[model samples]
Target: MDPNEVPDDDAATSGGALPRRAPGPPRPAPIAEIDALSGDPSFMTSLARGLAVIRAFSERRKSMTIAQISQKTGIPRAAVRRCLFTLAQLGYVHDDNRSFSLLPKVMSLGHAYLSSTPLPVMAQPFLDHVREALHEACSLAILDGDDILYIARSATTTRIMSVDLKIGSRLPAYCTSMGRVLLAAMPQAELDAYLLREELKPLTDRTITSRASLLQALAAVRQNGWAIVDQELELGLRSLAVPIHDTSGTVMGAMNVSVQAARVPVKELETRFLPVLLEASRELSMQLL
Candidate 1:
């Protein structure tokens, strides 16, 4: 077995097991600093509540009633109702008697960022090229908070992961190959703050929950200029990533190719995929110049 590949029968990882799932959709992660932000003069609580209400809807919970929205966001029913009313008035949401759903107009919100930003526009062609050549799923992402946010993707017809990842999807930075490349490029102090702030919850038996082990993995990424995650983010999913740099030679983002672990061995990631991924990373980085 590859040193990085953990067996399926392996026991719970070092840190701990994840919390048992509740029935229905999972509870939303809590909004960070919502209470502290209330004291800031520039912070708009109403706007925050409205955005929270909007975010509560997802692929799993597409159409929800006012009470459901309140339950999902932890916002009060009255506030949720008002926010939904305002959103419906603005045509961003639709109400059909019992439940409310997002409208196509909501795409405008994401389109504004996609249209204004050059990274996603520039990365798309490179991603397409990788997908066409390798016949595998490829993606580009930038570190956002403690997560890696997918900015662009070229997906294969065959799905490899349980989660449907697309632009705007987020995954924890600790276990993903792209996330590791981005994290390895961080300054010492910034990386330290990130390690201190984020919880390294074990997503699978292979996940590195021990701080020392994770630190060692990140050190290797920094030294090697690439990263490989073996079923750490999810069982049967493996990925390889390399850093994309700007003209200044500073790491700006990451590019990665993902494959099903059962179909591809771990060594192929370094042998077959690394060279192409590195070349693409270099070309995309130069384009940013």
Candidate 2:
């Protein structure tokens, strides 16, 4: 078995086992913060711009030009260039010919979350328990713009997506069950703005790439209290999700179960998987509160 395909510990891996994906070409792992800049106020803009540039690189666009950076971030071209230059100089970014991309140094920011946040740590054992009981891969995700970031996973060994995503993995929310659950918790205005700002893109042939269709789906998700995504994110990967809310009813996050489509239908997800996920969501939410 490949190293990533093996169990990292005695703990069970979903479908039996392993993964992490590099952010991209010359793209360093995504580091969200600058350690040295924390104590100095002067490093603020340098820190902010550098982080913005790093965020600009994603699954949709892995490599970007200066103008693309400016367009994506709303920062001026000059400032984006300066940040890229500084990041490149620091070994945080790369410059080959004219294109620019992040490097592994970027992973520092993502690693910080895994390192410092207790939620993922607390959720791991619980996620494993749930997955084993359900016999499916489970994951915890937080909303980030129009996408969901996979903060923790009770992942199956199966390679389902075109890309490999481990913890800190991000995917467009409109198309995933986890995304809909989190989005369903959002206030009307915020949801409207997000829908307007982000034009959904087709990942697989089944993806809800249309704005109107996504809104309709979100409406149903809001009314139903859970989300079931069938092959929208990827073919043969069906998932069910539920909102995880805190004591005051604020949505803290979401939880998901990904199953092979051949094994379960969308109805089966709502019937069999939803209750388990809802129980886990409630427990996780209670823990946060």
Candidate 3:
């Protein structure tokens, strides 16, 4: 059995439940992740290397040396240097002799996706409507890798989460309401692979770190057609989510309303917010069709 699934008897003998692990900040996708693709004729190794180098820079790591970039991305230093040089020449990055930082022109790369993708644009008014009705923050996101990537948001003045989230923000899929809904819609084989690979590290004491429990929670979501995650991602944050489907009734994304746990009860989320959320998602899904 996996260590993440602790038996009840074992937990009792251990005095208390196992300690929750707080994972470190997110890092760039390692080059090792794409190593299998190296042999594929269609795969663009140089482009992937350049993108990996770009991903190495973050809010905390505003600027980085070639060595630091290489270490973070698992690309060789020489490769990192070449990628950075190419990016600098393309006005995507700036190197000031010591460290390199992303330039303003880099915004275009993300802008291209946002402008071309109709989901965010179409979902904005619906998200805004939900936010106005609920007096809570509402967001639209899609399952990206093992995380949920926020694409659109309508936030109230009251900030619920510690981190200020906007478009491009990502959160772990296992513990988030939107993530659970998206996960629930996934095919069993894909879901099994995800559960096996993802580390169920707890972000809060209340977070369900057990893979078995998470599976049950996902099953419940599948049955109910919505997900309510109470203080799983953060101590005082609770979120409720419903799936947004496409024309063929395939789940395309998830939409959620987040509120402070202290201010709103789980009962309220299900009873009061669920209906309106369901309606908004239906409307958005129709729009997609």
- Work out the TM-score per prediction: 0.83, 0.73, 0.85
Q: Give the per-residue Cα lDDT of candidate 1 at 281.
A: 86
Taking all chains together, the TM-score of candidate 3 against the true structure is 0.85
lDDT of each: 0.83, 0.76, 0.86
Candidate 1 residue lDDT tens string, 42-90: 6566777788888778767789999898777765577678789999999
Collision count for each candidate, in order: 0, 14, 0
Q: Rank order by TM-score, top first?
A: 3, 1, 2
Query: Looking at model 2, which ten-residue stretch has the lowest summed lDDT?
Result: 27-36
Clashing pairs in 3: none
Q: Could you say which candidate leads in lDDT?
A: 3
Task: Report the CA-based lDDT of candidate 1 relative to the real structure.
Answer: 0.83
Better of 1 and 3 by lDDT: 3
Candidate 2 off by > 4 Å: 1-48, 59-80, 95-101, 209-212
CA displacement after TM-score superposition, residue 237 of candidate 2 (Å)? 2.5
lDDT by residue (12-82, candidate 3, tens digit) is 22344333535766433566554445555566667777887887777668899988998898676766787
C-alpha RMSD for every candidate: 11.9, 14.1, 11.5
Model 1 TM-score, all chains together: 0.83
